[model samples]
Target: MTSPHRPASHGIPRPRVWAPLHYPGFATLFIGYSVSSLGNGMSAVAVAWLAIELAHGHGAGLLIGEAVAAYTLPGVLVALGASRVLKCLDPRLIILVDAIFRAVSLALIAGLALTDTLSPILYVSLLGCSSLFGLLGIAGDLAATTELLPSELHVAANSLNSVTSFSASIGGPAVAGVLIAALGPGLVFAIDAATYVLLAGAVLASRRYQPPTPIVKSSSAGIRDGLRALWRFPALGAITLLCVIFYGLYGPVEVAVPLYVSSVLHASASVLGGYWTVFALGATLDALGATSIQRFGLWRMTIAAVAAWGVCLIPLGFTTSAVIGFIAMSVGGLVYGPFIPLKKTIIQRSAPGELLTQVAAASGVFTVSASPVGAALGGPLVAALGARATLAFSGLATVTTALVAVAVLLAYRRRTRKLSGDR
Candidate 1:
């Protein structure tokens, strides 16, 4: 059996957190992905803002919702069909194709906007087209990470990815706000399109450094194979379930937090912004330092994080002070940061290499949907319980879910151990 802790280097001292970047191929991919993610973060704001600009008076809210949905919902469908459509392609090729498609679609949207010909309908349709391959792109990126770095560095690599995403979330919107005021959302979309072209070029340039592609037996069962893999692997299934619940529970925070700040605390938009900014900063810090907790075990770390996140949210539920709310959100972000990296690390380690992308896509289908469903449900929850109570309810429910998960997982582990002993 192979040990899991093999060093990236033979003898020279190197920081474990940055170990994955030492590889040239991964480093190139990281830089391109980082640049592109910043663009993505900007688009997250620009898309909705542009939707607001184009929407007519009576239908503005509906059109904005449609535009946002167009950007995200297609990725769920793409992830669902990935096993069938993407089974034969190299992960890197999938990434390349996805990037090119995004670049073209976003460029088209930009062109239409610049020419003043972009209708709301066309804008929504193009946004949908742009995201059709989004989930596959993410699956390919993670699959490529496994290929580019050793197993031990996966957590660090994933954490670095998380850090980039969090940082972009902070910086992208701020930049987009400024750019949209000066150059308009159309030009921002053009900049975003350019970033995807750069990503495509990076993918092309990294070809020489990538190891020879491994042959995977093609599957016709579509996502069922990935689902079956989850059922067949106990650990994978458990972690996926935990993630679904965890994310689902967090969705209400998105809906409730702003409401809480406004209705309960009587605060301004700037206060809400400040609360989230602090949260993102804490999350970024935690993600940057994720490698330090590797020895404590990913499973324990995930569970602990979930529980701590719940505890953090409890404070917000009871507090009327903006300062207390900010502190709670900051701590919540710290605990929440490790959840994604840890989940990806476990999935990458547990799944067979050939099935990795499919497994990830399959997992994405559930995890991606979880939050939206929770957010949709949050409307009724907030109505019934009010914002402060809703926050408390989400936290309490999340803690209970984590406790139940722990008991179930422990029982399953003991049973597996006993069965192994008998065999």
Candidate 2:
């Protein structure tokens, strides 16, 4: 396939921001991806609530913590093994199979919940099992997108992907909360299950998206190949490291925000939802403006995003007013949203397409690997220091990491230029 920046046709004008949708297959893929993301978002809320409910207020915190941990942490192990699966299987088949697996798992969980047989261990196990496929699905989905569209549209398309995720996240929790209030968490799981069916259908319909021929595998292709491939691309490797640290440090925000709301602001759950919604809104807005930011260098934009995230979190840490917190979170989200899409686009452009799935899977491992670590640290830090103080430290640490990144990136670029000159 031609590079993303290449002209669509000799005499044709450059494609606009929404150009990817014009490709019928990509449109189908986007629809499916969005639907699936919405379900994932709803599940994010439902699973934690179910865990707490199953706890019967006994060790509810630990139950919910385990459930959350189960939902994501298992994906790390799955990602480590996913490169082998992606290497041996059709990426399209991998995505479709994952959707099927998740749909069945959710349906079973919904049934179990309704039957009042869902134990906390059982619930966490089911979610964790389903998430095994989740990591593989993400790797396949990104590789599929990179294959379906020309490389030039990667940024716009990824921006659209981000918008779908952020929009779903904003809307999903609100809808799930209401549904849970009226019908309980079981029904929400059922609905989320239905959405996965929709995702599966979309994947099936995208059969027309034929990827370019994959690289011929040598006998040595194995689990370690993904990480090795990632390191081979210096720019992508650096960017991926930056993403890991940022998410690692930002992990505390997940724990700290809710604590801050409950402890400091003495706010209602609605206030917590409002904070998340505003942040999602900011991310949605940033996704919309991604086309405008395309003129800037990716590394520059990435650094700025990291810096802005740290700066924005300061107000969130210090603020006593919900209004100020909302504004701060919104701005933080705005700055943070672009970094992810930017990171993905950079990886897509820089990495070999044939290794894209493995590289992405490896990237996922690095990116989320820190969340559990941060959570482990965050619990203690919050206990020792107030949630507000914990947030400030997280923010400051992220900014410092970003500053270190600036130096590292600058040096890397200079060395690369010198090497090219020598050549």
Candidate 3:
């Protein structure tokens, strides 16, 4: 058994399902990411709980919404501008710095809560400040994955990364609930902070396989270059546009899910909870053993996954029975799990190594930016269409978009092959 630390052959042999774990650096990176995911799980519960605690009687809902917005919106803002700064530094440094800022800021929030001096202004500011580091992720973590792992193992590596977050999604909230019950929500923040500290340590200890390939360009030029590369590559452009459509259309479903369960299905809140749990469970199970899908080819698998995801939602819209709906949602979750890792693997494999980080950043901004637009549209759509109609539209739109992208991708491949033959 060869150590994952040593470089290995780039053979596309039968998918050694556990091949990625052999790479010590990837293994270390995996652990750090998994821990961070757990912390994120805790943070989600803590932030919402704390917001409720700090809210007076009036405008409590508004305050909670604002705090959540503060945590998320800043990353979009930072991602827009940080590409140039990220191009100038090692991505690992950016990740480490982000982790450190989050740790320190979370600790401060805990301290303030303990002292009975926490205010909405201070709370929002700390969370916003802490979130700014996440914008660096466009260039850091996924880019680091490309740098550390061989091309053959990219899918497996991303699968592991995706699963870590899913695992955390399940465990983080449970533990956070226990701590909040025993101690308080503030303690959850402190625990989350400690997880970041551990993540930073793991990142600090791991090695980079490639040197930082710094791009020498003005800020405007760097940003332009990143944009131009995406536009220049038809496949990349199509995939990104597909991402925008799929993500935007899917956003409405988030709003529709709870509404459908409560109003349409006439189920308890726990049933809605079961809906998500089963979905996550399906995703986790699929990710753990998805290496076989690689045999079908990355592009085909990606297209199929997106279409399958949309297809899964159709059953949800048509079904009235909670059991049947749960089955549909679970299938969606199973198919949805592989889509992201496959997408990331495709991007990293196809992108130029030098511009990989910047390209990823730009794509990240585009895709993430679409979700809010989708969410904003979601409320109105649900009002107009109703939950079942909205869910059906969201699913159908996703499928239509995937089919269109597949057609475009196929045409592009034919042209490229023809041009190569002509040359």
| Highest-scoring model, TM-score | 1
RMSD of 3: 4.3
Lowest summed lDDT window (length 10), candidate 2: 1-10
Candidate 3: where are CA atoms >4 Å away? Answer: 1-11, 208-221
Deviation in angstroms for 48 in model 2?
Answer: 1.3
Residues 130-165 of candidate 2: C-alpha lDDT, one tens digit per residue: 777777787777777787888667778888998999
Q: Order of all candidates by TM-score, from best down to worst?
A: 1, 2, 3
User: Residue 49 lDDT in model 3?
Assistant: 81
For residues 33-139, could you state the per-residue lDDT of candidate 1 as single tens digits? 99999999899889988998898566888888899888888988877766666677777777888899889999999999988899998999999999998888888
Report the poorest 10 consecutive residues by lDDT, candidate 1.
Answer: 1-10
Q: Which ten residues in a row have the lowest lDDT in candidate 3?
A: 1-10
Q: What's the CA RMSD for each of the models? A: 3.0, 3.3, 4.3
* Per-candidate TM-score against the hidden true structure: 0.95, 0.92, 0.92
Task: Please give the CA lDDT of all the candidate structures.
Answer: 0.84, 0.80, 0.77
lDDT of 3 by residue, 1-423 (tens): 111232222344545757887877767767887888899988877888888888866677777877777777687678677755666766677778888988999999998987878998899899998888675654588888877777777778878888888877778887988998888888888888888898888777775533444544444544456677678755556567778888898889888999999999999988997888888888877875556676666667778888998998987778799988988988888998887777776677656677676777777778876877797799999999899999988899889878987887678768877987999
Against the hidden true structure, what lDDT does model 1 obtain? 0.84
What lDDT, from 0 to 1, does candidate 3 have?
Answer: 0.77
Question: What is the Cα-based TM-score of model 1?
Answer: 0.95
